[model samples]
Target chain A: MLLRLAWRNIWRNKRRSLIVIGSVIVGVIATILMDALQNGMIHQMLFNQINLNVSNVQVHKKGFKDKKDINNFISKPAKVETIIKNQPHVKFYSKRVITFGLLSSTDNSSGVYIYGINPSQEKSVSIISKSIVKGKYLDASDGREIVLSKALAKKLNVTIGDKVVGMANTPSGSIGSDVFRVVGIFKTASSEFDKTTVFIPIVSAQQMLNIPGKIHEFAIITDKYENADIVSKALQKKLGKKYEALSYNEILPLLVLQMDLYKQLLIIVNLIIALALIFGIINAMLMAVYERIREIGVLMAVGMKNSKIFSMILIEALIIGVLGTIFGIIFGYGINALLLSGGIDLRWFAESLSSFGVGAIIYPKISLENFIQIITIIPLVSVVGAMYPALKAIRLEPVSAIRYV
Target chain B: MEIIKCENLQKIYQDNGVPVHALKGINLTINKGEFTVIAGPSGSGKTTLLNLLGALDKPTEGTVYFNGEVLYKKKRRELSRLRLENFGFVFQAYNLIPVLTALENIEFSMMLLGIPEKERREKAITLMEELGIAELANKRPNEMSGGQQQRVAVVRAIVNDPDVVFADEPTANLDSKTGDNLLNLMQEMNEKKQITFIFSSHDKQVMERAKRLLILKDGLLEKDN
Candidate 1:
């Protein structure tokens, strides 16, 4: 009977009930959309940073990460490649020898990190072949050819089919210089990488550095990202401590930290909206109590207990909360689907997002946990918010209430 | 055979720093199966005395004994139980829950007593019929006439078969004709069911039909007839 009374009372003032439910729905929808956008942007950014920039796992010599000395190159590359190839989860692997060098042209000279990779194997591990915007990527038959970023090529006043001189320090403490033809101009979405990196053939790098069969790192790719840790750990245990295995997560700790901060900011915003919704609900319920003062008095005089009155008000709040949450979920997902299909182009903020390795276009994506949390939290907040008004209504005296308008 | 006995019942009120005595050392006794009317003009403490006897309010300096138990000394829950099980009230405004239909209003009391639905419905329907408002059972309070609403209020009060039915100006909102009819109906119920009816009213017609009348003036009983 009390539940029936509460159900009837909710519809008595349709506009007021809608206002309360509307506030809650707005909060829930905002929370869901914000969560989806943040998670999606983070996922896209991480995918680009890991798959295009860094491989799932990179094998480097122990103690070489802090100091990239020329002497730290793997002396036995064939044996290490044999073990890595035998791993069932390994989809693609390549050897890269990286070193800091100076590239000089007629007008300018700047420091650059030169990556020496096997052209055929590099395509299996990284997307560098697809990123070539001008000329062509280096091939096995193309001797002494290099690929320079568009920004770096422009700064050095060199283009495709131009000659550039690379100078670097060898393990013997001698300066080695080599002339290479720029065969390709690469344009990555990231400006920092485009300005600093130059790629050359692995055989050419080995001859210039005087390390005939040595490479600095083996970059491995796996089909599943979650398998990165497992493969890395298995390789570490099998190869002992001679080689260090690094996953993308360990290589990009700063990105992980930034994602955490973004998630925290989203949570704070969600809480503020939830608090506003709770206040709106409480206000509506207080008005409802005031308007039904006489009715409450009659119930009390007719022997309805104070607790029953309190529960009835709470029940009304619960109903409003549940209905609002359902509608909010639908609205939130609908808006998310619309925005996801028609991607949000942040071209105006392209520089800002690209600095963090994220694309200008963001797509919203929601997980099961986010949906479950929204479904549970809205109703709980409603019930908790109803406590004050319910207690106030219960404290009213029968005689005084009967006189209220 | 006294159902309600009050000894030295006192109630005081503070009116802008001056103490106004509402009930001053009053003593009264009423027997079972009686139609007792407490008659007084405005500010004569009739409602205050009725509130004490109905267990709705406590006396400031005295005790009220009902059915051999000290009503004032009981705990709040016990006082509520006493009101639910023994006392029924009809106020001047009718006090029918505006959201509920007349039938639901009568069943409200029975519901609080934890009466099952079938029994509560049967009793409420019979009481509404006895009050001659069965046809108005489905009508809300605002949809009904003043006399019809008051009759619904009467049905709600007596639905639980309470030991005593207390009404404070039960006919003040009705016309004289309806008021006379209501009073005669109460008198007939009192004679037929042998249930006690105690009311505080200024209506002369209500006082005339009472089997026993107590008139108050200046917070003291002026006459007992």
Candidate 2:
């Protein structure tokens, strides 16, 4: 009976009830879409870093990543390869010799981190082979061929078939120099990374630096990137404390921090929307209560308890909230589905977004957790909003209230 | 047998910081099965007396007893329960809930008492039939006429078989013919069910039908017959 009364009471002023309901619907949709957009952007950023450069995990000699000195090269490459092959999750691994060198063309010179890689093995670990924008990737037989980013090519005022010289410090404290042909130029999502990186055949680099049979880093790709941390832990334990196995999260701490900050921003935005909903609902319900002052008095005088009166008002508010939320979730998910398929095209801001390693198009994604959060929050907010009005209804003196117009 | 007893009933009101005494030093008792009327001019404390007697308000000074038990001494929750079980009220404006049908309004008090739905519906329909407003059962209060709405209010008041039925200016909004019919119905119910009926009114038609009359003037009891 109380439910019936409450349901009917809400319709007493249909326009007012709908206004409150409409505001609630808008709030739900805003929160859901905002959260989905933030998640989609962050997810793209993380995957781009992993696929383009970091692979899933990396193995480096102790102190090598900090200093990048020629003397800190991995001496026993065969032992590291044996342990990596034993890991079940390892799908592909590429060995590379890394050095900071100055590359000079006839017209310009720029400092770059040069990676000496086996062309076929590097393709299995990273997407650099597919990212070639100009000229062909380097071949295993081509000793003097080099592949550099478009940003680096532009800085050096060089193109394919241009002659360049690479110079770096050798392990013997002597300057090692080699002449190379620019074979390819590639572009990646991160412009900052593209501006300072180049690749050459491993044998050519080792011969130039006088470090035969030595490599600086092992880039490993797991079957799934999510399993990188588990595989890295296992490899670290087997390889002992001399070597460091680092996951993508460990290699790129800034990207992980960016994701966390976006999540906090999502929370703050939703809280602001929730507070607005609470106030809107309160104002609507308070008006409903005051308009029926005489009816409430009659209810009290006819032996309806104060508690029942309070419950009736609260139930009415909850009905409005639940009804609005139902429609909001339906529409929110519908919009999310449409955006997920077609994606939000942000190519207009590609220059700004690519600076941070995020892709141009984002596909909005929502989890079951998002659904649960919206379902619980709106109805709870409705109850809180109605509390003051319900209390006011029950506090009126019956005799004076009955006499009120 | 006495159903209600009151001693030195005094009610005062504060109108913007001025004390206006509405009822002063009135002693009264009403017996069961009596068709009684408390009559007075405007500002003569009839409504004030009814509110106090109905336990709807607290008197500034006085004690009201119902069936030899002190009415004001109980807690507010206890008073509400007592009213639900033993008292019925008919207001002047026919204060039926606008959203409910006539039958729903009639069964409201029983619904509050946790009565079964089927039982309350049957009781409400039977009472509406006796009052000749059974056809208005499915109609909301706004769909009914003034007299029909009043009949629904009366049926609602007495639906629980309350020990006392208090009517405050029940006929003020009705025409002469409708007011007489309402009075006749109340007299018939009073005699047939042996239910105590107390009314506060200045209508001559109401006073003529009453078996006992008490008149008030200037907040004092002027006469009793």
Q: Stretches of candidate 2 above 4 Å error?
A: A62-97, A118-125, A138-143, A170-177, A202-226, A339-341, A367-370, B67-69, B116-119, B126-132
**TM-score of each candidate?**
0.87, 0.90
Q: Indicate the residue-level lDDT of A188 in model 2.
A: 86
- All candidates: CA RMSD (Å): 3.5, 3.1
Q: Give the Å error, residue B107, model 1.
A: 4.0
Please write out the lDDT profile of model 1 over residues A124-181, one tens digit for every residue. Answer: 8877788899999989723799898888988999998999998888999998778899
TM-score of the first chain of model 2: 0.91
Clashing pairs in 2: none
lDDT of 1 by residue, B1-225 (tens): 899999999988878989999988889998999899999999999988888898776688888999878897886567667777787888898877777899988888888889999999998888777777889989988899888888888777777878899999999989999988788777777888777999999998898888889998988888889
Candidate 1 residue pairs in backbone clash: none
Worst 10 residues of 2 chain A by lDDT: A364-373
Please list the C-alpha lDDT of all candidates, in the order they appear: 0.84, 0.89
Please name the candidate that would achieve the greatest TM-score relative to the true structure: 2
